[model samples]
Target: MAKGKGKTKGNGRSKQSPQNPPPPSQCETLEEDEIIRCGEPAADGPRCKVHQAQYRTLYAKYKAAGKVVDETKAGMEMPSKEHIAQYSNLHSTLEKARRIRKYLEAIRVEKAGRDMHQKRFFAKADDGHKIRLKVLEKQMSAAVEILDAVQARAFDLHMADDPAREWVKNFQAAPLSTNDEEFFSAINSLESETDPQRDIMKQQRVAAAATTNDDTMDADLIDIEMRAKKASLLYVFEFVTSEEATLQCMREFLGPENANIGAKSSLSYHTLCQYYRRIVMHDPVLSLKAINKRRMHVQFEVLMDKRMDFGLLLWKDSIIEAMAITRSKAGTAANVGDPKNRFKVLGGWVFNTPHSGTMSNETWGTLLETLAPIEANIENRFVRLCNTFDDLITYLSFGALGLFPPPRFCSKTDAQGRDAVAPRNHLSLCGCSVNYNFLYLGHHPLRDEAGPQGASYGLKWRNGLTYLELFEMSPMHLQMHSYPDSGQDLIYFQVVLYSDTDSKDKFECFGSGNEALPAIQTRTFEGPPASVTNLPSGRGEWEVQLSASDLLFGTKQPEPGYLTLLTRPGSSGWFFHFKKMPVKYFVILDTVPHRHHSILAKHVAWTALCTHGFGEGEYSNRKYARASDVMFQKRAEELLSWKPKGSWTATKMGD
Candidate 1:
């Protein structure tokens, strides 16, 4: 074997191999000097004959100076696998630090002692250093204890015991006249459940703050004082900014993906509206709900809602719960079948493959352009489109029916060329979740109907269709081939149909026209959910409310460390366990989203290479997952090893 491309990734060597050559068709935010691109028009091209000497001179000059040097020299550079790995590790550490900092700031946890932690601590005491240091140490001690069994406060190297151990003493709750239990409860929950030392400190303060004559502390007055003293406008500002940053991250990362191209514009525009709509909320960062109607396009809506952990006080709590579900048995599986058919035909939305986060906007755009309904290049584009269609269906479910009132403002009637989100009635009510448009076919009666007669018509529509009969349907022969063999091959699918309302029997639906279609084994547990009363129906939408847990995490048991959360947010403040991140960080992600898997590949690979005790600065191709492709297979678990693919030498998992 030619020592495949990954073998020499990080030995401080660089060669032009297809795998490691300049990343193709993707957008990257990089320091100007660190990028290397291939194939551009001479004038537009980098390092071409016309600009070679100048390019070399500029590069050499920049390198000698040791800075980003310039910003205009475009395209990403190729680094030795070692360099990439090292940089990735640094980034991961910084990210964790950032997350921790945000958590502290959210809860008013800051460094107490002289310049110890950053100024972002909980409260400012006259004995500031002592009080803050104690709090920091207490939290650190708790975390370190979880890392092992030792409950010793001195378990951490950074957190040393100070003579002033009594400082982390006063987290408390005063009565609120507003009776907004949520806000008050949120504060008390964290305060009461903290370490005993912290609790004891609080009690001592309460006794001191108490009036000797009254014998009761004026908690309300004291609480108001604390709010005024501890409240930060900058914190609120950054919260909104971070939300926008996150939305932009998804838009720039996931929007270009093939998996999201289905209601491409709808999702994007909806999210855009949300972003602008929230431009001036609570403290004015985002409360601008009225956006220009024209700007709210379908594709833009795709970026709107994401993780609700944004401004939450219990950010760690929510994610920890989600982590449990993801790490549990049911989160992992190998169900690589046709994704689109899996959602529509099989009526299930579970993923089974590790994502390779490849963050390439240009490449995904090329793919999106390729998938466009042009008269010429339909076949080539549809192949990739069909394979990733399951992800698209998931998007429709979470974004369309899962949220209400539309993600954005779209009041105009139908037009000639412009496209928007389908009328809500066009949505699908699958076994449990709601979807839009049948993923398997474009054919439907009058575009929207949930009535029994419409259901009967739907049966008739597919009854004689040949494409419905096969387990595997080729995208190329979609309309050309007739029923039976025309239905393609559906042997890989498994579909179930739940009623609009409840009942004991959940009816099983298949790709019409044949028995060969994959069978979605019906369940005795989940009765028919979407039951209908009217035999004739019009365009009325369906909505389903999901628990925070359901969207935040997946089920546990039967499969440990297996999570299949993968959906695009369709509205504001949306939070669904997303697919395409690592098993360690996030449980839900694309089995083969977009090119959605690309983000997973890049980030996970980045984290693994940088963290996990890997050698100094070595990265592997295996660490870099591509959102455009599904990469899980035999020995796939080995990819979890911390070292770069080229340098790793360890016993694989599940051996």
Candidate 2:
């Protein structure tokens, strides 16, 4: 009986009754007062497991919030610290609640997944289950309340703490008046507050945008008045000298400077030539003949000879000053426009002379009469100035003489001389290289005095794909530009070279031998005209050399002539000139192919060939503003061996 009693008690059966007493209030809810905050289930003991877990979580969050408030309060002032501490505590509490809510939600998800996997979706849970879920709901509710309180507190604190933030926060939310006038007034106040110069800045921005398209930005508003003067040929001379390192190099190579040039001494042509030959093997007289046509177009040999030299000895300084003034004009002046107030010399001196274009016998006589009485550094100044001009030529020429002229062709005996070359059978497919973009034969009325009344054409070479070829062709283009302008109704199309012996510039028009009449044949065109009374006109492509020879000798026998445009005779005149025409290109051409040669060297040679044809001998056929070529050549030749000082050297240039 005793064992049975003990066993029953151990089994938790009531001692008084054998039947179960409604399970002895299995849930604490049945025994606890309705007023108790949590109705714990008896299975979970005196504490409600769900509510107990929530209490622990809330207590932990409260402790963490208190700690954070304490730490933040350590660095603040009394008033601010108090206020912020309160807010911080509230924020931490709210954060803790959020974490608890998330944890409970995760628990719910785990329960749901377990129930689904176990197929217990329809299983009935006891009051304990209900209480657990209810506790979670209550926790979420409390967390939300704390969150709301925290946010309200933080907002109040922020409003009192940060004015700028507060202003930004309320700006958009501030109410506007319903009245139109009040509304506009409020808007204006806000606008001014945001930007004091709102209207002005807006106007400025609009104006600036408008000016973006103004052309003035691309142009200079102030005009720069130009003083007419020549570009210093000294630079060109320097380039040539630099290429050969003329003076210093020669001095080093020859062991000593030629006392004749290095020191102030009267230098004759032969002596100067010797000095130059010894230095860099250059000759000034020959160099003058080469580039004289375009620069210093005067006979140096004749002017410097004996009696002429005597005349210069009397008026050398004046001539030097005159030449210096002329060079300063850089080809801008049509003629020496009244030499007075025109030329500036060393020592701030000024003088006058005859117009450069009127350098005739009459002008020379007048200049001599005016300058003979005046005394100056006649010999020294003249030599110095002439040397300067020579230096320019030598540098520009790059220390070289003329190229080999084609051998002369004797058709009668089929013998060729070193002076000239005949065309190997004139090909119908002849093509001349040009350096222009396009050739245009445009016409403008004479009544319209808008500059030149001539055609503008280009000489662009084709299919060379090289800069050297382009450079070689530039002279040709310059020649075309330099050619004499065809007068009104007169177009000088084809430039032909004839013997000076031909009185009328006439030749056989047709036929190969005696039967042939005067005619112009090119790579593409042929015409003397059906009748002699017609202006040449028609589209035709012709091959012509853009070279020195072409400039010196026109389309003549032995040497090949340039191909050109022509017109038929007896037709409605193409250009409408009622007389014969003289066609010429001021620049010369070399028939030898330069594509395989050094362009720089070739240009140097070319520069040493063309001269102003005032007379016969190479040097005597020209005019010079300074002293003799002898002095000039001496200086130029010295420059050939010139070396840069120290270790520094010059960077070379090309054209």
Candidate 3:
């Protein structure tokens, strides 16, 4: 103890080593304008965690203001995670609104039920229910108003961006028709700045118009524009080197450079054609010879005879007769006189391309003028008689076998007390119901009613040609017409065997080569169908020969919805239902067969009643039962051998 006390004397100024200077104040740095700071020092760094967080937030805010960094600026900093999130919030609101609209649409059952119930309640006429129904209806109306307002706002918001405007502009420039492909393969080609939110907005656009009917035409046009934009984008991507190249081509083709072109000159069509030309010219994979031989390049022809080649399928008189008969049979009053058959054609015509000079100059000139704009950029532009490959195949179907001659112009009243209007187009028949080339081959029922307008592009060919031509003049046309590739058995193979052009789509044909082509065969039945004494049940034999795979219920169970068949005017389109069900039903769409009857008839009253749950009225309920109380009834001795094994088994059936 004594020694320790003495050793403390050397640096006796309370030599506690200054008590190891107190640790730096355990507090965060105070902000410039703030008096107080965080109480504890941060585990890592000069400032406490709270102050660190505060600084990061402030830095992020400064960055989000889009302020660029400058070395000279003393307080410049990067944005914090929080600031980045805050900036994205603007777009997120729009996305959320889109999602909400989608959800609302998806929940349609609730809305439908509400509407139906409200209507029912209103019909009750009771004071209480009436008041409640009125309230509900008002609420629904208000809701619809709010929804419409929101949709308009969303559309405006989307259009505020440059990318959206560009998309819309291109879409409006080119539109797809009802006959065009339903889907565009190139919708995803262009990358837009606001693409992250595009999907939601797109759904909103379609859904907003889902319930609207008054603006149906405008909506349909908008839809067509959208589809065309997608198709154009894809077409450009595939054929053109880049979008810039496409734009350049479009500008050259559509601008004032082609002042002689018609006012109806199509920008999208030219863009596509130019792109094809560019690729064919530059790409080694393509050849002019090959392109010339393609279906689009070659012409198609159908041999016409008095009895074998009807220009169209359904004769106008026949359709009228059928409609009258059907109505009469259905217990409706109608004129019972027989319809005079005006059709006079009978055999399948040969299919081949015509030689040069075989087609008239008027035809060539018209084709050149009509298609020059479309084929201006092709390597070997030519107007083949088959205008489009589809015309050849479509014109020679069932109804066309009975071709009729065009009516003569009559100034005086005819035997029927009706004066005939002057013939306008090339078609000989009064009308056709389901002719594929109806637009090209026949007179439009309304032709006389319409003023002297130009014929549609499809019907511009001269009388000498069997097929329509779609191209203008080109070097290849001269060669094709001169050589006129023939003896190639066009029936067996889809394409001409003379060239290397590939099929535009997959087609099915029997056999393999030239040998297969020779072996291929077809059977035809002349005259009326065989008559039968007793008809079988359940639509025994179908008029159309559709494969089982084509049927709606071919291999599946019964579905909730009905199937649709796309029937043409003159063709007796058929559908086969292979699966047997407990009950069978039928619906018929009838068209009037007169000159002014071109307007498709709509079953308005029936449709309205069916929609309101008053479907087809009740039919008679049979009262007959088996004489024997037993489940099975005895058959005649002669028919005993034809008896079924069980309830599910049945006798053979066909008409």
Q: What is the TM-score of each candidate against the true structure?
A: 0.19, 0.16, 0.17
Error of 2 at 622 (Å): 34
Give the 10-residue window scoring lowest on summed lDDT in candidate 2: 221-230
Tell me the tens digit of each residue's lDDT in model 2 across 446-524: 1122222233232342221111001122122111111333111111111222222245334311112322111212232
lDDT of each: 0.26, 0.28, 0.26
After superposition, candidate 3 runs with Cα above 4 Å error: 1-126, 159-423, 426-655
- In angstroms, give how far residue 550 of model 2 lies from its true place: 16
Best by lDDT: 2
Which order, best to worst by lDDT? 2, 3, 1
> What is residue 537's positional error in candidate 2, in angstroms?
37
**In terms of TM-score, how similar is model 3 to the real structure?**
0.17
Q: Could you tally the backbone clashes for each prediction?
A: 111, 63, 23
Candidate 1 vs 2: which has more lDDT? 2
Flag regions of model 2 displaced more than 4 Å.
1-254, 263-338, 345-655
lDDT score, candidate 3, position 418: 40
Residues 466-555, model 1: lDDT tens digits: 111111111100011112221122222222222212241322323334321221111111111234441112222222211111222324
Q: Tell me each candidate's RMSD, in Å, in order.
A: 32.9, 36.9, 34.1
